[model samples]
Target: MLDKDATEFDGACHCGAVRFHVRLSEGLHSARRCTCSLCRMRGAVAVTARLGDLHMLAGQEMLTLYQFNTGTAKHYFCSRCGIYTHHQRRSDPSQYGVNTACLEGVSPFDFEDVPVTDGVNHPSDGNGQKGDGIIGVLRFQSVGC
Candidate 1:
């Protein structure tokens, strides 16, 4: 079972141009991989945080935002170094999926069986197939918000 508790964590981009602090309330229990057109390319494992759980400690000016498709999910990255930092989940606007590999002392493998979701058939798009034939979807069950 997950710890289901909150703790402070810190992280930054490759060039350290962007830095931020996030509270890991679920301790990567909600960690996952996404296969949206962009996520499939970026290939980063991510964990969840409430909007307030993230605080830009530095380099806010150096952060860039990219929106595509429906434009609901906003992807943020370090403008200076082009490292994806986090994204405002289209699945859940109130929560951000901070990059798991970017966390200060945590590894994506530290969590048991990280799951991947099928963004290509997202429920948000009105026809999600809850794993269908995807690999990691069996573990996650649904592309949850």
Candidate 2:
């Protein structure tokens, strides 16, 4: 988990075509994964950030946007390296789900446990409330160096 005080982080794409700084809404405590079609395929752990909290520092033009299904969520990636960086949440339009691997000094494996949400039957889709859609938890265990 990230230090509670560590709200901000610098991030970049795999090819360095995109760079950004983000201030997490609740640091790594908001880390989660989604079982949605796109998310399941992307297989990324994400932390929450307010829409305005993410600031592009460079290579804005190198970023590409992808939206599908309901088209409420807007996924951004690096055009050069095709690295998913962030996405405006479909459940919460006010927030962005930032890829943990894109952040400096942070990796998906850094989290011992992360909640997995059921995006398939999303609350916004009239399935149920947000927390009620929790699928399960993903745990990471490091054995040896």
How do the residues 1-145 of candidate 2 rate in per-residue lDDT, one tens digit apiece?
A: 4564578999999998899999998988888999999999999999999989999999999989999999999999999999999999998999999999999999999888889999889888887656557789999989978
Q: For residues 7-120, what per-residue lDDT tens digits would candidate 1 score against the true structure?
A: 678999989889999986576767788788998899788888999989999999998999999999999999988999999999889999999777787765556566778888
| Residue pairs whose backbone atoms clash in candidate 2 | none
Q: Each model's TM-score, in the order given?
A: 0.83, 0.95
Candidate 2: residue 22 Cα off by (Å):
0.7
- Angstrom error of the Cα, residue 113, model 2: value is 0.6
Worst 10 residues of 2 by lDDT: 126-135
lDDT of every predicted structure (CA atoms)? 0.81, 0.92
